[model samples]
Target: MPDRKKIAVIVAGGSGLRMGSTIPKQFMEIGGKPVLHHTINAFRHAYPDIRIVLVIPEAHSAYIAPLLVSFDAPPSITIVHGGETRFHSVKNGLATITEPAVVFVHDGVRALISPELVRRCCEGALAKGNAIPAIEVKDSLREVDDEGNLAVDRSRFRIIQTPQTFLSEQLLPAFGQPYDPLFTDEASVAERFGAEIHLVEGEERNIKITRPLDLAIAEVLLATNK
Candidate 1:
């Protein structure tokens, strides 16, 4: 049986500068609901008993609190103030989970993530100390330089995604170290502390909404899934 008390941390602290949006991408609408709302609903639908901690911009908590009712989200979800960086935001979210359980660190904009995927990630983390959802890079890889020049071998690269799952005990301690600007995700933090990560096949449809064009693609994906 899976750990019924598993916790999830949804990181949504980005300014959406890359997307060129005034609002954070997580707060943007997708298929008639906010992206973050869809992301949280996936976990809730997958594991009704699991606890959720949402990491949002400190300034947006008051704005988001009332919006929860619009999404019909559960009252069980707790909102934490996000830090300056994604790494720190995850750390803030992780700090709120207070149990011996498996935890999932998910990107709030990756709303296409399925409940089945979430369950698989949680199960993988429970069986292994750390787990990351990844898809084999089918396209030929290239390493680009600062001047957009190509370099090096691409054979070993794989595209990784979330929810990256980990044993709560194993993950919480890794966050205690000094923050590094280079840390991109939870897996990097765990790897820095010498934790072994097991990889599971990630769904191709599980794409992050980072650009304007992606929203149209996501709408099509949502329609197809329905």
Candidate 2:
């Protein structure tokens, strides 16, 4: 990749309503450290030289700023205020990168993302212009039509995960366009501008901590990994 700058934008825009906690889900702890801490650490472990942009709610940045100093190896991270929506939050992060590089857009609550998986995503993005982590759907799925619910082929569908990597040249420009309701993730946004998204295998443990049960599962998973 010729020493290209690798950057990761971790989006922590969730409130704790689903988790039923007073704190945001990302600020909650899984294995001693906060979920956002673990997430940022994963990227640092994968690529020590990578720059990180954390897009979080402006109100929460004060809570996280001091906490970052506690990291054994504090990373090159910049905190950006999150926008109204996920797409806008990502756009806020993307705006910081004016140089050509490889960028990864990740979910802050997806703290279980491993160093190995991060490497795979970066490598895939270096080869192809973009790489999105995804796993095939394992459960039976049904589609609703005018007739009624009908069985759908699960094999054709994939459960997408993040640390969605892309060449900044492609991504930065793609975000320049106006937002659309269908721009669910970086891949969708890139696709809107006719950029191809390549898929890489994602670990099952790379789950987002949205609910109370999810944090418990992540604790167990983190312990198992250790």
Candidate 3:
């Protein structure tokens, strides 16, 4: 294996509107720590020397240091102000990179991301050039149209998650294009950039904490893990 830098670009620009809290979802506490801290820790746990580029709303930047201090031992991080949209925020995060590396663009709210999954994504990306984590959709699906709603086959679909890993060469240039509403995630942006996406199994417990209920669930999961 070649010696390559591992970089994590974690985006957490949510306004906490969904969670109904003044604090951003990423800053919300779970297991006695901010969700964003857990996210950064997950990457570090996977690769202790991995570089972390955290993109957060400008308003929340001040709270970051205190949160890091809460860690057993704070790790150095490069913080960037988020952009107007998630796309722009991620673009800003990608701009911080200047070297050849394996980049994992992850959601800061997905605090439960496991070290195993982080390593898995890195390995898949290194072997195939890019790797996106996804899981089989378990719920029944419905298609709504002008006529009505119809049940669709859930087997053919997968729920995508992040820490979408890619080589910096492949991922960096993809964000160079003008922003589009269709660029929902790193995978979407890369797909539009003409890179074939490779999928790896994602953990079911790796849930994105978007609501109060999610925070509660995460607390339970964290306790169970311990």
Candidate 4:
């Protein structure tokens, strides 16, 4: 087969409010390095030739510039101001991707995502048009009502994560639709456009850091991997 097209995007616009930190979760140090830096390095290690597009809050771009410089980030890396929500931020990142290559949309907090997982997602997207890394829900799930009452079946759920991959063409138009708070991720947006999304089994370690305790868990994983 011919070579697969190449592009990757990282969304890091989290305000850290949930984590109750003064700084954004992406900038928080994990095992002596920023979470976002580790996440980007994973991709670079996997695909050195892939162009990287990063989306961050507008105010933080200046702060991140020097970090990129110190790390000697790939020359192909480009930064864009992020939007208010994850969906919006991804849309902003998508706007900067000018090529028809396949793209992987990842969360910066998911610093443990393996290079192999990223490659798998990208390859799947190339063949299927849309792909997302997901894992079967092992815990008993419940749909709670507005009044905190259990409302649905527990066996029909799956916990989704990212490095959600897509063809640039398929994804570009999906983001053009009007924004909705209900739209959670790139995969959701694409699905709304009638894109067939394939699910790849994701690694258990591909966790998104949302709380202070999560940082501790991440550090343990990083140390074990090292």
List where candidate 4 sits over 4 angstroms from the true fold: 69-75, 146-153
TM-score of each: 0.91, 0.96, 0.97, 0.91
TM-score of 1: 0.91
Return the candidate ranking by TM-score, descending. 3, 2, 4, 1
RMSD of each: 2.3, 1.2, 1.2, 2.1
- Across residues 119-222, which tens digit of lDDT does each residue of candidate 3 receive? 99999999999999999998899999999999999999999999899999999999998999988999999889999999999999999999889999999999
lDDT of each: 0.84, 0.90, 0.92, 0.84
- Candidate 1 per-residue lDDT, tens place, 1-226, comes to 4544789898887666777888777888878877877888889899888888888888777658644875654448888998878888898998887778889999888999999999899878878887899987777666677778674465577799999999988899999989988688889898898898799878898898989888889989988894
- What's model 2's lDDT at 195? 92
Error of 4 at 18 (Å): 3.3
lDDT-best of 1 and 3: 3
Between the candidate structures 1 and 3, which one is better when assessed by TM-score? 3
Worst ten in a row by lDDT for model 1 = 66-75
Candidate topping lDDT: 3
Per-candidate count of clashing residue pairs (backbone under 3 Å): 0, 0, 0, 0
Q: Native-vs-model 2 lDDT?
A: 0.90
Residue 161's C-alpha lDDT in candidate 4?
Answer: 92
Error of 2 at 139 (Å): 0.6
Candidate 4 minimal-lDDT segment of 10 residues: 66-75
